[model samples]
Target: MSFFFAALCRTLSPRKEEDVAEDYLSRDAELKVKSQTALHNSHDSVKLIKFADDTTLIGLISNNDESAYRREVDRLVSWCSGNNLELNAQKTVEMIVDFRKSTVPPPPPSVMDSPITSVESFRFLGTTITQDLKWEPTISSLIKKAQQRMYFLRQLRKAKLPAQMLVQFYTAIIESILTSSITVWFAGATVRDKQRLQRIVRSAEEVIGRSLPSLQDLVDSAFYGRANSLTCAGGKSPAEVANTACSHADALNVFRHRCNGKKTCELNSPVFEQDPCSDTFKYMETSYSCVPATHRVVCEHSMAYLNCAAGKVIKVLGADFGRRDHTTCAFRRQKSEVEKIDCTNDAPFVAEKCDGKNTCELRASQAVVGDSCSNTSLYLEYAYICTDA
Candidate 1:
């Protein structure tokens, strides 16, 4: 059973200034969810999801054993009651997503002595989610909301409003609805469902007498950099605007440098050495994935060998040849030597040498990765993953 509850940089002139700034607002939700998750030590078979005031419990029941799930639910109810918070059993719902054939519906768990409602689908947050996990209900709801907003765009057009204003209106009202939580459902949406969404954009275009960015374009080029947790976690970020009118070839290098292994990052526009689209208004657009990697540490003046099992090859993610901390190569090193911890030299050479190879050796010496800080001990710290040969 599962329960559902709902919840930019500007660069200056040409000299390629690479200064990273701190971002606190973007880290709030991720940190909140993580902290809350740590507080609840439920059974391994049960998962708890909490967002704002909403709480959802998902259980992996095997062999008709739901003891863990029920125990967690009871604990949640007890927690709420102890906190002087009353749960609305009438509003609470449970939906089981079982794929096995010839199975019976699971018993409903009670909340506050009243049986919780059982729903085939429920609106969690703003997106409508069903047991089957299909996206039609969510998409259809969006289409209906967008179609209703399109009527206002038609009225604005009839008033002889400027094209720019009409476009803004459509984007603010209609487009927002059509793309709400898009990253969750768009990729899995069937071709027919995607078309239903695009039709709304097309309808708004007809009303405003101007071409708007298609749904696909909006999804593909929504935002650049790891602005939020979702964007970094392979989900589209609706907070940032899309600027497909411009493109930058060095975006990969800049982003990889600042955000390759970090959880959260921010970049200014000046990071781009040469702005590809200078004349048009521009914003960065990119997408990246978070993968599990293996880390290797090698002290300076030593060689580190990276290897993979049979039928597998190495793929380097990112590496640094200089020491960033005192603990890395602190063995038999002077305090002054290890104190220069700000050193970090790019290790692109490592990637070039080890990528796609089954086994490789890396020498952590000045000859290979130059000493960024003089008289300081350095180490080569790199991360990589193995893939099929």
Candidate 2:
């Protein structure tokens, strides 16, 4: 009799639970509904994903035609009004994702006369995404957030916490942020960006008074077939190692351009063979991922000469060695050689002198290049482009 009663109770329980779930679903549907619209004669559709009180609309705008998106925004606003739900204009934000060779600027989208702010990058669903699809911004943000939590880690250190407990705390709090979306963004992160992110982990290791494996090492350990060898030049100081690594970032940029949209690409190929740093030490290295390239140019000029900073070579594009007019060649002396002396021919000489060195200083005095004109006090005016080695 007891077993029969138990069977009856179990059978009735599901029905009661189903009724309650059905009532909640109905109430939720009435309170919040998905916003949708058709475009181009229903060829394209905009759909919204509704979760409780939050709604996110997803759609495509071809040729930068945001008209459909604007219409949907208006529709959502109208629906909210009909449902007696207040739409917060201040809280509304929009992000544009463009993956074209030539992208058109999107016009400002507005709702209820308030212009929504467009962002180059924004945080959504715990991930930072950018218009250019680079992960530097997200890594930077994660580093900053992890750094803030370092203060607590310091306190734990001062409190004489056990090494194991400290490591656990860091793993639970700080490392969690660094590793949250690593799989998604790691492939597109530059070497410099990865090093910056790893520095935080190194700091935690230092604080805990124990050596810990890096994120890359952990990844390699997890995936047996994905390990790639990294070889550093022997006898390199820590600073030089960093600089060498930075030069590899250029290769990463090229890799991204070729493999970003492709379905598959070889991890080791001759396509990524350029050496930007021209380091004396050679290493057999391979990269398993791709990321956008970053370039920097630095120039310095003085009355005596011009110099290109280390890691750069000066390529003089054009120059005027003599006085032209007051406005044209102000650097020229009052008493100059000829009215205008073309320094275009001197580019080869300048390149020969400054090409390979870390810092190249070229003297503007007559000693380096014979005086073009005796009477006029001429000044050197020049423009040059710096190219990475």
Candidate 3:
């Protein structure tokens, strides 16, 4: 049996706006120091995650045993007490996920002798997460918000706003709401949910009297590495710049070769074989996404081989040399050892060494990527894509 547990822990209230403005940098430094100072002792089955003012403790209970989970909670309370930070138990909550066919409910978790509330869902860092991990509620909230703002779009159209102005308004207001966390939920959205979201775009297009880009088009361009726009405009005046839109034929090829499947890239300056328009100031504008990738996991002390077709080369998306979850390489390991779920060290050098190769071998060892979690059997996990050589 397994139990997914999450606890929301709060600390002291933030300073006033005026106080923050008086010494913003100092205030930020103080917060950073405070975060570093109030450290949570290492635990086997629990991980502490902090974002600005919120602290969340997440644990995976194996074999229906919650000893480590409960210990971590008590440790958090003790740490906060030692730090003189008030942990508002009234506002703290616990959410559990258990999917056994027949099982007794676990006792509710408490903080400071107060019974922490159990919720079906809670908004964490702007994302509404339910016990079942469904996206319906979050999507519904986004749709409602977008629809309410659609009223303002209609009012603008009635006022005889220009089509360009209407499109900009839709992009800034309604579209932003619809796509607030598109990457997180779009892939998991139901067919009906996707159609509902697309309907918002269609309504905006109708109001603007021109065909607006569809939600799919945006997702493909932004998340699937398809370039929606690439141009080089040059001339002396605004009209000249608007009229001149010439780009080298090999621009697309250059971009793809350098950044097709990488997570992040930097092109200090565009290097073209020959500038299409060299007479005037010609600046480049490009928008593309990193393509999707397949990932593999290699247990500690093992070796991994990544390969692609003869004509393709490896393009690393991301690589980490530690455990992020309790289950990945947890075979025969102690519960405490497997519970170090937050241990992760990014290995970007893996990309530097493996990218552009047709086949690559990786050694998952502390010698290659220094140990990120002591006493824990870490593993190598990486995601990559195969691109034309």
Q: Candidate 3 on 1-389: residue-level lDDT in tens? A: 55545555666534433354556666564432243365764876788887776778888888888888888888888777655466788778888877778877677777878888888888877778787778899999999999999999999999999999999999999988888777777766778999999999999888889998777666644111212222333334554354344556665555554444445544434445465665434554455434457777889889878889999999887777877677878989899888886566777667978999999997888888888899887988777878899
The collision pairs in model 1 are 6-125, 11-270
Where's the lowest-lDDT run of ten residues in candidate 3?
222-231
User: For model 1, how does the per-residue alpha-carbon lDDT over 1-389 read when each residue is reduced to its tens digit?
Assistant: 33322110111212211111122344442211112223383688877776766777777788878878888888877666544355666668887777777788777877757777777887777888887889899999889888887888888898999999998898889888988988778866879999888888887877878889888766654333333233233344443324343456556667777556443445668666676644334456655544456777788889989899999999987887776667767988899889987667887888899999999997888899776788888888788888899
Q: Write the per-residue lDDT of candidate 2 for residues 25-64, one digit (tens) a residue.
A: 8777443332344212222545565544555665576555
* Candidate with the larger lDDT of 1 and 2: 1
Q: Report each candidate's C-alpha RMSD, comma-separated, in the order given.
A: 15.3, 20.0, 13.3
Q: How does each model score on lDDT?
A: 0.71, 0.55, 0.73
TM-scores, one per candidate: 0.54, 0.43, 0.57
Candidate 1 local distance difference test against the native: 0.71
Candidate 2 regions exceeding 4 Å error are: 1-54, 64-67, 99-104, 217-389
Ten-residue region with minimum lDDT total, candidate 2: 1-10
Cα error, candidate 1, residue 52 (Å): 3.8
